[model samples]
Target: MRRFAPLALSAAALITTLVQAAPAVAAGSVPGGGHPAGGHRTEVLELVARQTQTTFIDHGDPGTSQGDELVLAGDLLRGPALFGRFGEVCTLTRVGPEPDSFDQQCVGTLTLPGGDLTLQGLVSVTAAGPGEVTVAITGGTGRYRTAHGVIEAVNTSETETRLTLRIIL
Candidate 1:
């Protein structure tokens, strides 16, 4: 069991590295297409988030669960500001008859006070365990830019729950 701990820790570290590195590929562009009206774009200067009630457990049996809320407020280059406050309730269940295995599910809502932005999403445990989870956004409208495409500022929301993504971008 002790030997497995080192392996598990290594695997978890690798997963975290991969997730953090993926976002550096492209930091510009919207999802759908086109730039903001009049070519005015808002650049995300900094993001500060405070998450409470977030819980984590090692495995099944005697595991613990908790509920918390999060508040994230950030600044944009333009006059628009971004802020999101959401409550999260999640459970981590040890994966059946298997050691070092667990699953987690989190459902929450994100809201932006300055702009027409809102998000209703669920993040679930995946791959290795609770450390790795997939996020699915259901309904919301906001502006996001990436190298792949430009998501215009519109009332667009996920209808069919799109694809299972490992990152919450």
Candidate 2:
């Protein structure tokens, strides 16, 4: 019992030191409050998109019409994925938005040998006054089939066009 006295006292002092060193939780501040630990605060905006019936003139020929219904899910600041038939297996990374335009990098796997392809472009928001924004993808490249095709044909053309996208945030 006599020998245990100093040991117990030392243990109590160590506990006191630890308690003093422990970080205090602020009032009304819960664990992991406001934002998640190490997680970026993201604002997700959903947009209902409609492409024009006009096909890209540079791709094949004029009057070649192809329309796509896209569901764009992304952070307003950070670009999002354009999901739909057109976005079956692709991911779009939003770089930043200019004064009236937003930039994005579209990356996806090719269907043939299935190599990776990246298309960088910008979308100009013509109107963002209301709950919706009308945007037009100015231009982008469509480079694909590089893994299986020849080097000459591997380089596909890119275009900037006038297509209206109705974004519903």
In terms of TM-score, the best-performing candidate is: 1
RMSD of each: 11.7, 28.3
Question: How close to the true structure is residue 158 of candidate 2, measured as C-alpha lDDT?
Answer: 16
Scored by lDDT, the top model is 1
lDDT of 1 by residue, 61-152 (tens): 34332232222222211112223434333334334334444343334433434323222323223345334323333334444222111111
Across 50-162, the per-residue lDDT of candidate 2 in tens digits comes to 12121212122222112211122111111233332122111112212333222212222111122222222222111231112122222222322221210000001011111
What lDDT does model 1 reach?
0.26
Q: After superposition, how far is residue 2 of candidate 1 from its true place, in Å?
A: 13
- Rate residue 30 of model 1 by lDDT: 30
Off by over 4 Å in 2: 1-85, 88-118, 128-144, 147-169
Tell me the TM-score of each prediction against the true structure: 0.37, 0.17
Shift in Å, residue 19, candidate 1: 5.1
lDDT of 1 at 123: 29
